[model samples]
Target chain A: MRAIFLREFFGYFRTPVAWVFLSVFLIASVGVPWFLGNFFESNDASLRIFFRFIPWIYLFLIPAVGMRLWSEEKKSGTLELLLTYPVSLGQAVLAKFLAGWLFIGLALLLTAGMPLTVAYLGDPDWGTVASGYLGAFLVAGAFLGICSACSSLTANSVISFVLGLMCCLLLVLLGWNVFGDLLLSLNFPVPLVDFLASFGVLPRFNPMVDGIVAFADLVYFVSISIFALCFNRVVLHR
Target chain B: MSAPHSTARIEANGLSKSFGEIQAVRNVSFSVNPGEVVGFIGPNGAGKSTTLRMLTGFLRPSEGSASIAGIDVLKHPIQARLRFGYLPETGPLYGEMTVVEFLRFVAGARRIRSVELDGDLIRVRKVCHLEKVWHQTIETLSKGYRQRVGLAQAIIHDPDCLILDEPTDGLDPNQKQEVRDLVNEMAAEKAILLSTHILEELEAVCSRVILLHQGEILLDESLEAMRKRHPLFGSVKIRVAPADADRSLSVFGKLEPFVERIDRQGDHFLLRSRDKRNVSDAVLAVSKDAGLALLEVAPVIPRLEEVFQELTRPQSKFIEEQG
Candidate 1:
């Protein structure tokens, strides 16, 4: 597992994907607040505006990171070589997931300029900033897990990316009002809609952005990640 | 370092695999003793790769079992895997990593202790001639260099048994020779099972050859025994003028009762028979009848190529069924 983690983590930098992902993510995370969110004009000392665009950016970026995790290995036939080693399938999957998640975490860390800039200009709400970062990490992990699951379902990276995008889109839509309105209009059970909305990422993520660290929200994101990883294992076994 | 073991280093019993409706391998059973090189030879779709994959634990066998160094592969995969090195047909590699980094990663993955990694890696690099490309990324290296890197990774742990599938598949003659030489050098210490369709590859390195045809074992014997047991053995070769070739062929064709096969080569004809009966008299009589002069005639020794062809021929199935 250690070996796989090292190889996969360093592998991202071997190509342009890691660099490109970091730049795009950093620029979007910081630039969105400065140019559109009125970071300077509002005189608000919190990173709440910056946190709003994370889910939308991650919906595409996390897939890009996770899409090749298994698909490239399968296509290049390296997965056979990998599995034939002493490592178990579960170990391999965990190592790959952690590496991708850590990579996204590293990208998140690079955007430290955002909070630092907020701190430089005024007294920033450090608690909210920490919560926001934590929430973004959880969201990235969940999205990465889903993308990795999609990657295991096929040998084509493009198909894996598109599949991952669709899956993440569904999870994102689950929390949005449009989906609930559509379901309500269609005369679905109100209890069912309420239960699913609670499961969506937005419900858990919104509170974290507001410095509200609920145990239930933490459980929600962590469970979604664990479920995706379990699904990945099942797909590979088949 | 090259001491031999008394027990079989690699063993498979009644192994079989099926992908949905297709039964790719059927009851394949074989064993390799230490210091012995076994060649798994077969035609395309003959279950060579499937059998190797099953033995390596990359693909689970639907029935039966395999063991390496006395450890059951399925029951204890990591233990079994630790004892053997396998190179699939493609020699799958990490294109982004430098040769040294890749080798280091394999060593680490195989769980080699940090203390021994440096020494083992140095020895493997020397053995594989990878010193030149140590720092070069795998994708930039030539195919031969990449194959060597693949080989280096396989042997980094110094396994007791090695299973290679078409190790020389796409290599040039020089690279193939290099791989063959490496196999021969390593055979003194490790039990080796090589899967290849190339006949000469077996002849070059294998002491024993397992011939598979259509998911069944057709022949399992030592090279010397195979050569001697071939029906083409003790055959006679005769050469006559081009004009007499037609008449000589006709004459030899008439002796179909005595000849197994009559192979023609320019003005030369090779007459094979299952029995040691001297057919020279019949050939002389035919030459006289046809008013042809025999240029030369001599006893011919069958080659490994002929033995392989005879064992793998479609008609051999009928013969085996009848027998």
Candidate 2:
């Protein structure tokens, strides 16, 4: 597992994919708040605009990172060699997942400038900024897990990316208020709608962004990541 | 051929695999002992790769079992895998990595740590002749060099057994000879099971040959025993003039007691001998008695290509009866 992690973590930088992802991610992350967001005008001394764009940025970028996780190994015939090693299937999956998550963590670390800039302009709430960063990290893990699971289902990288994007989009849409409202209008019970809405990324993520570290929200993200990783292992085993 | 050791290093007992509804291998069984080089020959789609995958713990067998050094591959995959090295049919290389990086990764994965890793890498590099291209990227290397790297990775762990699928499939003639010699050199220490369609490769390096057809083991015997069983072994050909052809036919029939079989084609007579004795001398004696002129007399050498064809051809009388 350590061997796989080392290979994969360094493999991203060996190609231009890691650089490309970081460049685009940093630009979009900082750019979203500068031009479109009411950064200076709101004068609220917080990083709400930066946290708001986290899920949208993760929805697309995580798939690009995760698409090649298993699809490349399958197409290049290295999966046969990898599986024949002295490691189990679960170990291999965990190694790959941790590598990708750590890569995203690096990208998130680069965006430290956002919160620092807010603190320079005015008295920004440091607690909210810390929680927001934590929230983005958890969401990135959840997104990457789903994308890696999609990667194991196919040998084509393009299809893997598309499937990963669709799954992430679905997870995001589940938390959208309109989706829950639409179900409620069709005579669905209130408890059922609330139960389904609780699984969405937005609901679980909103509290963290607000500096409220709820136990249920942490459990939700951890459970989703675990479920996605297990799905990845199952897909590859078949 | 040397007798196989009682302690088998590689064993497959009634192993079978199926992908969905299509059965790929069925009840195939074989064993390779230490210091033995077994050649696995088969036509394409004959389940050679699938069988190797099962033995190497890459694929699970639907029935029966495969063991390496007496460890069941399915029950204890890590221990079984530690005993053997496998080179899959595709050469399983990470093209983006340099030869050094790839070998280091393989070495680390095989559990050779920092201090001894360098020593192991140097040893494998020397054995595989990879010194010149050690720092070159795998994608930049030629196919022959890539194959050498693959071979180097397989043996880096210095396992007791090795399974190689088409190890020399795409090399040039010289490279092929180099690989053959390398296999021969390695055969002294490791039990090697290699599959190839190249008949001469089997004849050159394999002490025992396993012929598979339609996912079934057709023949398994020592190379010397297989050659001796050929009908053309120790056979001699003779030519006579048209005038002496009729007298030569009668004389040849009388000489059948000293030979195994006689085949007649026009003025040429092919006489197979049962033993190493000179059949041509007896034919000359018969010719002298009949006053027939003998034009040509030469021993015929049986070819391995003919043996492979004879064993793998479809709808043969022997296979039909077995069915």
DockQ: which candidate is best?
2
Residue runs of model 2 more than 4 Å from their true location after superposition = A185-189, B1-8, B240-247, B264-267, B273-296, B318-323
**lDDT of each residue in B4-78, candidate 2, tens digit only:** 334438899999889899999989999998889999988899999989988998888899899988889889988
Residues B86-134, candidate 1: write the lDDT tens digits: 8988888999999989988898789999999999989988988888989
Tens digits of per-residue lDDT for model 2 on A1-238? 8999999999999889999999999999889877788667877788888788789888889999999999999999899888877888899999999999999999999998887887888888889889999999999999999999999999999999999999999888888898999989999999998888877999888888889989888888888899999999988873
Summarize candidate 1's per-residue lDDT along A166-201 as a digit string, tens digits.
999888888877798899999989998988887678
Q: Output the TM-score of candidate 2.
A: 0.93
The total number of steric clashes, by the backbone 3 Å criterion, in model 1 comes to 0
Q: Candidate 2 falls in which docking quality class?
A: medium
Worst 10 residues of 1 chain B by lDDT: B314-323
TM-score of chain A of 1: 0.95
